[model samples]
Target: MDSEKLIHKITEKKALKDSKELLDYVSESGENTKEYIRYKTLWAMLQTGNEMDEETINDGYKAVKRNVKGRKSSLYINVVKYAAIVVFALLGGYFIHFADFNNEIAMNEIFVPKGNRTSVVLPDGSKVWLSNGTKLVYPESFVGDFRNVQLEGEGFFEVTHDKDHPFIVNVGKHRIKVLGTKFAVVAYPDDEQVKAELVSGKIQFDIHLGGTGDNYKSLMVSPMHSLVYDKTSGKVYDSTIPDGFYDYWQNGVYSFKDERFDSLATKIARIYNVEIVFGDEELKTRTFTGTLSVDDNIYTLMEAFKIASGKPFEYTFESGKIYINK
Candidate 1:
């Protein structure tokens, strides 16, 4: 089968015949090569859908194993190997993480350009999910009392536990410190608000008023709570995480609820890698509430937003840019 057909089978999430055809193709492609490995991972993910639980994963593996038990063939071996890869990749979705080893303390930076999101396993084995248009900087390895890292955009972190070696994330004038935890930080330099959401564990949030770091306010953020700091007014707003919001954006979902169209446009611009110009300033004030898949057409998304606002929205694409009018 061709690449398009194979992707169709995986995405359609349909019958087993499509999966068997893909399996046959992979087995014939030869030993655990890159191509075979890729297919195997996809096949496993497809079998269980995009999301899976512990029980679902277990049952899916056993069922797959049963299909090839009597054969004792190489296909069975390939399936087993694929199963292992899926268990790991699907834990956070399919992504490739590689660490560059350098003996020197030279700083390395990973910049996820507009229109793409990426995940990295840091030197300490902590994983970070970077949203589009984000930059992360750190040393090649950790060799100090603190694992210091800098962030210029939004990122979700799952920090590895280390009591002696504390992990600190520096976001401009503000900083977040943790021993180990899962949390998200949104500190885009241009944005007026810097937001932090703690999913689990405790984190210390510090806001510095000066370069000396002497005059700073600190607070502890508990699990399942979130805080947003307004950079202009220097006011902090605390609230519970809103419903239908999650780090799921790492997996291709651009979800929002009752958000302004202009803000939505900015997010779409980042992911679509496009510049947007609005002919009517009033359009920016409109609000939209919906979930968008990164795979959906940008124009279609715009139309949906207009429909939600009940406004006359029109757009034209030219010179690789989007011009919107009402």
Candidate 2:
């Protein structure tokens, strides 16, 4: 096939009867013929409203080269480049013809570092507030019959209502199923317990344990209720918690009711992005019941704890660590 006729066929998106022969001619052609074919083909595609990125063309070239191995002569190189353009242009046309190709599922991951919190609005309009050191994996768009996401650390979700498409969160060994509900999930990988606190609506929590006869168990949780699953004991417990207690951290408030200092220290360390070392063993058993604003500096927050404890407390910060002594 002549260069002019080949370019015309490519631009018109018509099947070439002698595609191999045309490829051979382009590969054996002189520098002038090769350049003319390359530029003319590009201009024709542009005129036909076909735009392609360099990366996509390069990827297509690599894909074709991987299937056919040998020394890459100038002829082979030119043929590869031409093949890449053809493949990419055909793919662009295919995407244009099938609208659903735009909706192909893609996974997106978000990480929130220590001392910082972040919020994301999902493709379905559901909002998620991620706590410090949290990792969330979600789809770019919902497909199939349900919407699902995976969570690590902690997150507060205000899911949009879609009764037909229930939203599911997979945290550790537990799965939370909900249909338009506000809830908070605390399932840090380092923690021994996973807790799901419902702010409104209802959620079903499923625990999966392999090998046992009653390996799978489901618990329905209502508003104002918190479901706690102990990984060590393999037990699930439900308790009534103060409304919004789970989500207070979203607003920089750390609320605790008779929380041990040991556990509180962990929260403080995560929120302040520091390590807490207790110099006095007795401080670990000390219980605290109050709300502390995380917006304050670490030293100020520690001072509030000292005042609440009514004990002589002192702390030193060094090397990104806080040494608490009494």
Candidate 3:
């Protein structure tokens, strides 16, 4: 295909007959490769008008052969660049897409560093707010029977309603299945427990059970309720949580009701991107009940703790860590 016509088809989001050739042409551009990449990625968005039906395109290596009799195009594979809005997901800032050359299948990933947050819009128009120290993985497009995503750390999702395409979030051995729901997930790989809180819509929390791993039980979660599953014991703790507690960190406000300082240290570390050490074990038992703004300096927060405790304790910063003592 001529470069001009090939480029024109892409702008229209049409299926490509020679996807490999397109990549070769792009790679041969040398110094202009970056520009070419940006150009192609610019049109990555799925369009509404004059759109090529997805069934016309063959994606992935096996998919090409499976759909050979019905294929209209070879493969419509496009590279995902940093900060590009993809038909799969609107990934802003630092993001990476890994693909298999044989198959047009690409796995997209986004990481939010400590002390930061990112918001993304999926192709289905579902919105996700990723918390600091979080990583989310999804495909270049929703394929097969379900829309699957892997989440590590924490994220808040306002999922678009799609009865046919159920949105499923995989966190370790568990899964949160929903059809148009608002929820928050806390499932850091390093943590001993995983939690899912439903904000508005309903969700089904699937917990892996039995020794063989095939046995499982699904619990329907209602709005304003949270399910915390302990990793080792396989215990699920169901409780009611305040409406705004799950998403308050997005606004830089940390609210809690009589939560222990030590219990909250790990979250604080993620917010401030620092390590917290308790020099005095006694101080860890002290519970705090209030709201804290991320805008406050570390010292101001320590002072607030001092006021809450009604006594003077010592806090020092050293070795990129904060040490609190009595």
Top lDDT hit: 2
**Candidate RMSDs in order:** 11.5, 15.6, 11.3
What are the lDDT figures for the candidates, one per model?
0.69, 0.71, 0.67
- lDDT of candidate model 1 versus the reference: 0.69
Please estimate how well model 3 matches the true structure, expressed as its whole-model Cα lDDT: 0.67
- In candidate 1, how many clashes are counted? 0
- lDDT: the better of candidates 1 and 2: 2
Model 2 weakest 10-residue run by lDDT: 94-103
Q: Write the per-residue lDDT of candidate 2 for residues 235-256, one digit (tens) a residue.
A: 8888997744754744578778
Q: What are the TM-scores, per candidate, against the unseen true structure?
A: 0.67, 0.65, 0.73
Candidate 1 lDDT by residue in tens digits, 1-326: 65435544533443323355754664463432234334423443344233344675576577556654555555455455456445544453334222232332334465666766656566677878776688787654578799999998888898999999999999987899999999999899999988889999889898887667457899888688898889999899888876545635446776677788789888888778888888988988887777887677888876776677786778889976889898
**Model 3, span 1-326: residue lDDT tens:** 44344555455543322467555554454433444433343344223211122432223223434433432343222222111233223222334343222244345566767766656555566777776688887664576778999999998898999889899999977899999988999999999999999988889999888566656789988788999999888888999977458437456677888888887788788877778898878788888888776566877887778788855688888877998888
Clashing pairs in 1: none
Clashes found in each candidate (C-alpha, N, C closer than 3 A): 0, 0, 2
Name the better of 1 and 2 by TM-score. 1
Stretches of model 3 off by over 4 angstroms after superposition: 1-102, 210-213, 246-250
- Candidate 1 stretches with Cα past 4 Å from truth are 1-103
